[model samples]
Target: MNAPSSLALAVPALSLKDIGKHFDGLEALRGISLDVAKGEIVALLGTSGCGKSTLLNIVSGLLPADRGELRIDGQPAASFRDWRRIAYMFQEDRLLPWRSIRANVAFGLEAERSRRAERIVKAEQALRLVELDGFARAWPHQLSGGMRSRVALARSLVVEPQILLMDEPFSKLDPQTRAQMHQELLRLQRFKNITVVFVTHDVEEAVVLADRVVVLEPRPGRIRAIKPLDLPRPRIPTDLAVSEQVRQLRMAL
Candidate 1:
């Protein structure tokens, strides 16, 4: 497995410089800067109201930054709107209640004007990738929490994006389920070779899942520190060194 900071075949995926956002007179984020290398899994660790979601929204092009510059794959973010290259998975599954799992997975592909047959084919392929192919015909309500999460993940992957933005996507799951999702995430990220920016308050989650954990100070969010985990893959939280790393991460936060 490739280490966190090691260079891979893929180049830089995303870059942000002095990025800031404000609504009315309140500042949500201030002078936040970071670069996510291609195929890197980076976690943004911060408490609630720290603008983690706001930063992700700016990166995903859902919201424009009030200040600073951004580049995606070396292209200016201002002129780039090809969102098929950047996908998002949220805290909620956000699956359409009325749609089947397969349809939900293919929902984003419709924006690309994909044919119905093409969408189903790609969606099924993506479901298989997430080990949810058997559940493609099932409804969201019919599956377990983990299964639904897998469907959500498959939905994000179905579009074959270069980067994945996850905003505490598994925070709602139980401990066992969350651990399963961690493994699933590591497997899929390695398989797909996509850059990931995962936002969460869970220190162990960030340490276990990411190559680097970027901690943000709350209230007018600013990056406090960037700690690269030099530990091995499939990080063992119970291990002495991994525990120490998590302790350090908590201290940084």
Candidate 2:
């Protein structure tokens, strides 16, 4: 075999090659191939039932593809075998009502077999990462929607995942809070160099948050369009370019 290219040496954080998925005779995705580089944010943009969430599940390894290949960090997905390197955040906060915020954040670490003391330390650090340290002892029901989402994000980050898969994590938040979470998410992703692939139906959300917006075709979704955005950081939604990009993406869909 020839030597690997220098480009290949810089392995993508996650990759899917012609991945397909079927559920109960329904084709959810087909010929899905994409790549996410470390420190990049990519969004799967489409309407409900377009398999955006299904694709996210496959990338996170929570759901298996019926066909095609996968690779993580330049290694075969099956052979790489370190699930700890990936973390997922869903639309629901899914925090345990009985557990404290600190405990909820530390839950995954426990799954990783981290020691109680160490789990607490890392969970606190993760909370700090999301600016929720003061709320560690609080109960899940005590938080606002945005705060709960922050806790969920901290939970995902506590394990130090190299890739974060979000399934419309901010979808339930109010408009203003959703915008704030978008900013915080970008800041955290940049600070941690964590690769992110999130699914969103909201066109403006995709334009505002993703480095690239991938529009998926409806039912048995396939890549419809991949639009790269070069907006400046702390993106202004009302900016002409942003408005135009959103308009274009809406048109694309």
Candidate 3:
């Protein structure tokens, strides 16, 4: 395996060094460092208050770290001008109840001030990517939980982001639906070769979706371990290797 320095030379998609954050003197994170390779899937795994979301928010530019350096594509985040290359999906789908699915998917592009025609085309393409092209006219309340999740994903992808940040986006789905979403995400990630960083408390979800899992400890949250998974694709929860890996991660947490 190459050393981190060697990997750094290749220009990680996202990088953080000694990243720290606090909320009114309560340290949420400390010495949090990580490098996410281009097109790789990395999961920030930990319980509540462990700063997983905090770290993600910092990377997304929603919140600034109290102390640390963040780089995107080798450019210091402060100097990085391509904010549109990154997109975030929160735990809630946050789909507009008043808008049609296509309109909601096109919402991401509204900030770019693109022509309405172009946004519609891009939104349609994204909906097709998520297998929701048929639901363009449907409303959020008309879809199932899984379908709603797909709509949320379509909205995120409509921007054609190079890096995607998700905060427990599928945590509310049923087991079957969640597993489906996992496959959907992996498929989309592979197809687009998009780098992904997500926060999750699910050991099995992390084991299934992440190329690497960064486990964190709470109370001034810090790294506990960074484990890389080299398992085969479509890692079923019942498979011995997958189950064992999940068990180990659960133990670590």
Candidate 4:
């Protein structure tokens, strides 16, 4: 595997070989194969209803594929396993109205009371990671859309998952906020060395953030094309090199 950095050289975190999924009579995915190295950020780019989210769900164990094999660090997907190594952030913030931001972020850590103090420290550190430190006491309803998204990100990171599955987490934000969050996510992913498999309908966003951009064909989705993006980062959206690459990718779509 050609990892961008040495930190990404661990065993494959997640792998899907000939994975297929069907919902009732509708086939959602067909024979999809991919691998996410320890710290790679892979983007699945396609139009709406392309089965990217379904594939993500299967990998996350929220859903089961009807055919083929899925594995986590070489273990078969169907085996009883520790799923704590994977974290998911959906399009919606999914914050708890009853819990404060700090409490919500710390929710996952509650089971291990033997290290409550350390968990609290980790929660605060995660909040800081998403630049939401001072808002720890804020309620979910009080935050702006972007801030709420940050809180969601903090919640995911607090668990220190080896892999993150993000499903258009910033799609609801305004354009400006989305751009800012993109840069922030790049920084966070770099610092944490977490493998990320993100589903986005935006071609430009995929071009900017992915080490490889994969497009799935419509209904009964299957991998249509896999394009490697060798661009240097931090990517500037308006920069000629980046813009041209994005245009070409969109054209291919």
Candidate 5:
């Protein structure tokens, strides 16, 4: 695993400086600045319309920032040079009804027929990583909600992007499924050592999955506070200490 440098100001896997955004003369985000290091899982926590999704869109290049800059591994957004360096998992699965699971996972490699075979192999591995290997031939509608989310995750992982941006991907699932999926995510993160920027409205979810949780204020959004969770890995979500800390973090927000 790549370790973060000792310096606090060291170049991050993803960085945003003085980022701002607006819609129809209304400011959505204001001067937002943040840095996420490689192999780190950082959560953006806030209430509805807090610009969390907007900030995520800006980073993913889905929406342009009105001001400031975004950098991935010290390079500007325009300097990405390779589209494969970033993978996005939106709230919706967005899978094509016509495509099978394997095809959907290997969608990005469609143009390369020769490489398509290799991509399908990799896609199967990704599905296995998410415990959905047998569902490769299934249609999107055939799967459950949790299974659909896993498919979305597999699609993102198939690209092997250096930076993964997820926007409330598990918010709609039931509590039990959400907890189970959280464990799956942590396992995958450890196995892949991927850098993740997870956006969530659920404070407990942030506390559970994040190495560091950043709170954003609404109405021209800006970061309010950042809290570090120095807890040991493979943590049981029901642990008393974890629960206490999560409660404290929620109160602090």
Candidate 6:
């Protein structure tokens, strides 16, 4: 993949300034500030109740921060008109049982009210991107766990999002399948040059995939440390350097 252009490096794909969120009387997130560069892969690493998912929700425009500002592609998120440029994948696959794999992949386009033929074409392309074109007509229940995850990923990518937010999307997969998904995600991200900010508690996963890992502390979750991983690609967990990085991240958490 080519290096990010100077202009792309200049403007952040996602920016949060002193972001704060509250639920009832408890503060979920506080003083959270971050900038995700275009085509960069960032991981939010933390234990439960550390607001990793909460922060993702705010970035995805599903929840509003009580204080602070959010900007997408250099514009204030509240005023950002190109919301279609963002797509989110939650923890669960969340594929509708009733819909075929192709239909499920096309679900995101429903909000745009596109014609059925156009949605079908785009959905097919997305399935092909995830290497699941053959299962287009299959039901969600007919696929394996890993295949379902790819379908979920295909659903997210069908919209051609510039920024993809994931909330522990592969946490449920077995170790081997999770590793495969990690590679798949990296390949697609490189191909699409999509900026990614994903929430993950696994130190190894974060170290393996992130350009930078933002560790958060619980109880009004706040940034504890930001570690940039400058390691080489295809970072195997068994490798000395990669294992050391994972060890350090685990210590931080």
> What TM-score does structure 2 among the candidates reach?
0.95
Question: Candidate 6: which stretches are off by over 4 Å?
Answer: 1-5
Which TM-score value belongs to model 3? 0.96
Residue pairs in collision within model 3? none
CA RMSD per model (angstroms): 2.1, 3.3, 2.1, 2.1, 2.4, 1.5
Candidate 5 structure quality by residue, lDDT tens digits, 138-189: 9988999899888888888888878888999898889988888889888888
Per-residue lDDT tens digits for candidate 2, residues 146-216, read 99999999999988889999998998999999999999999888888888899999988988888888999
Alpha carbon lDDT of each predicted model: 0.90, 0.88, 0.93, 0.87, 0.86, 0.94
TM-score of each: 0.95, 0.95, 0.96, 0.93, 0.92, 0.97
User: Which runs of model 5 end up more than 4 angstroms from their true locations?
Assistant: 1-10, 111-114
Q: Which candidate leads in lDDT?
A: 6
| Candidate 5 TM-score to native | 0.92
Q: Give the per-residue lDDT digits (tens) of candidate 4, residues 99-183.
A: 9999889886775554867877888999999988999888999999999988888888888888899999889999999998899
lDDT by residue (tens digit), candidate 6, 28-58: 9999999888888999999999999999999
Q: 1-253, model 3: which lDDT tens digit per residue? A: 3225575547899999999998999999999889988888999999998989989899999898999899999999999999987999989899999999999999999998679999999999999999989999999999999999999999999888999999999999999999999999999999998999999999999999999999999999999999999999888889999999998999999
Q: What lDDT, from 0 to 1, does candidate 4 have? A: 0.87
Q: Tell me which of candidates 1 and 2 scores higher on lDDT.
A: 1
Report the CA-based lDDT of candidate 6 relative to the real structure. Answer: 0.94
Summed backbone clashes in each candidate are 0, 0, 0, 0, 0, 0
Error of 5 at 66 (Å): 1.1
Q: What range of 10 consecutive residues in model 4 has the weakest lDDT sum? A: 1-10
Best by TM-score: 6
**Candidate 3: RMSD over Cα atoms?**
2.1
